[model samples]
Target: EETHPVIIAGFGHFGNTVGRFLRANGVNATYLDIDSDRVALLRRMGFKVYYGDASRHDLLRAAGAAHAKLLVIAIDNVEKRLEMIETAKKHFPNLHLYVRSRNRFDAYELLNAGMLHVYRESLDTSLRMGVDVLKMLGHDAYHATRMSKMFLKYDEKNLKKLAAIEDREAYILEARTRMEELERILQEDTNNRLMLQVDAAWDDASLIKEATQQATAQTE
Candidate 1:
């Protein structure tokens, strides 16, 4: 049998999908889940899965954990997720470990466990949905992403700068003034109403339509 490379621990919904996608490509994947029902279902579905706890060294080693190219940890239970990550990091250091975290705390423990590539799975999806809402309301996708990233960076920078200030009210006032100054510097040289109109028409659809029509008219 040609051996599968990925060993996904915690074959819950998230992990199950990952295995299924890999299997569709003829890439065999081994699974580890504490849930007996899930394991049995996978086995019946013709997947090579282990009904075993991933934290145990023997269990992982038996599942070819050392030779496995990648380890996907998608256990919903935060405690179990950390345990799996710890075991993988300590014993299977050669394996690249990816973890799904439920919250900020879970991410912290994973990062502390020496795993950098940890994902708060639902966060990105939620953010994408929010961006889609903004897009439908006439925001450009590229600009929306840029503005979000820039605002986050700017907030963090200001927070650090204000960390040492003695008066909170004074800090707030100064920050507001600084923001106004920066906005004025960055904005187009036009009245606020005109700028708003420009922004409203700045998304991909409108921009493309305008560019194409203008080009066609020029050619004519």
Candidate 2:
């Protein structure tokens, strides 16, 4: 019964990534997965993984949950994720739980349940791709990055704030209002940038010359 500091409840993509990185850094973790085939394959490859239903307290205990300081819930199923959270909270109250949420709605539920580190699986990556899209569309890289950061900050704050509102009508109104406000701010930013570009001293020829010189310097 060797105990590990970290216990991962899922062995899918997200959980596997964490486990691989942790192992690369010499950190051993006990991994529990419902997929018996994956468990057998990983065990054959010299990885320590146990096949069990992680939502069960007995399975968690068998996976060294009592001694584990960190429990990562990377299960994809919403019901199972909630069940795992409830079970962990009840049995391993001392463990620091990190949960993977499918969206803002899932995050709201986790936040309301008192889990502090709930990660939205797609939000950050999607925002990063959006920032790159803005850059490719001729926006300044720094500006695009700043705008993306601001958007993420506001969205996260709103997710937490809106979670407390119980009335569905009020929630919809607040969400709609926030969306309009964000659109207005972005529109203003776009107009201001266009105005600045229009008023710049350098015309197309000078801008082209500057770019040509930079490219020539890089080549030389």
Candidate 3:
């Protein structure tokens, strides 16, 4: 029987936050990090974590790699991330890896390897924080986080959906609808920063126009 469990590798900012967030939500997770100090700190903080490199077969196996469900590669190093991915996919064939990539190239590599859930770490959170700062001094941690998550889902869906159609006017119409939906959401959520709201409006309009033009040009 496979004892699948959420496994977080690399105890940097990304990994630490993931572990803490999961634990706060009452989800059990194990941490694998090469930093001895971080491992010790997390262990002292009562988290199930250990010091080790994830790219090594023995270390991953010891970390229950065979039965691990979700593997989060939160490390900053591009090389290390690839190594971990290769090892995990090769050894733990069933593991679903959620990788944090530095840029589009890294994302492409991960995607080429059949790793889907790749995140551009810090980009979303930083954007949300910037929006919050622009809106006002008021910060509601929970609401901000929730709104950010919603925004990401909406943005990702729109971006991917827009890429499929070859019609310029159709793409523009779809983008306009998305903007309207964003505005409606912004109005409904008091947590949204006013500056962000304004920025989103203009940004969405510009994006819609550009997409429409590009699609039109491509088809012609």
Candidate number of the best lDDT:
2
What is candidate 1's local distance difference test score?
0.73
Candidate with more favorable, higher lDDT: 2 or 3: 2
C-alpha lDDT of all candidate models, in order: 0.73, 0.89, 0.77
List the candidates ranked by TM-score, beginning with the highest.
2, 1, 3
- RMSD per candidate (Å) reads 8.6, 6.8, 15.7
- lDDT (0-100) at residue 182 of candidate 1? 48
Can you write out model 1's per-residue Cα lDDT over 154-219, one digit (the tens) per residue? 543443444445576986787787677545633432255467777887876688999999999999
**lDDT: the better of candidates 1 and 2:** 2
Candidate 2, run of 10 with poorest lDDT: 196-205
lDDT of 2 at 148: 84
**C-alpha positional error of residue 122 in candidate 1 after TM-score superposition, expressed in Å:** 0.5
TM-score of each: 0.63, 0.79, 0.61
Query: Tens digit of lDDT per residue, candidate 3, span 1-220?
Result: 2343888888888888888898788887777888898888878888777787777888888777788788888987788888888898788888888998776445656666677787866568676776677457676666666677777777656555555555779978987898789757855776446668789999999999999999999999
Better model by TM-score: candidate 2 vs candidate 3 = 2
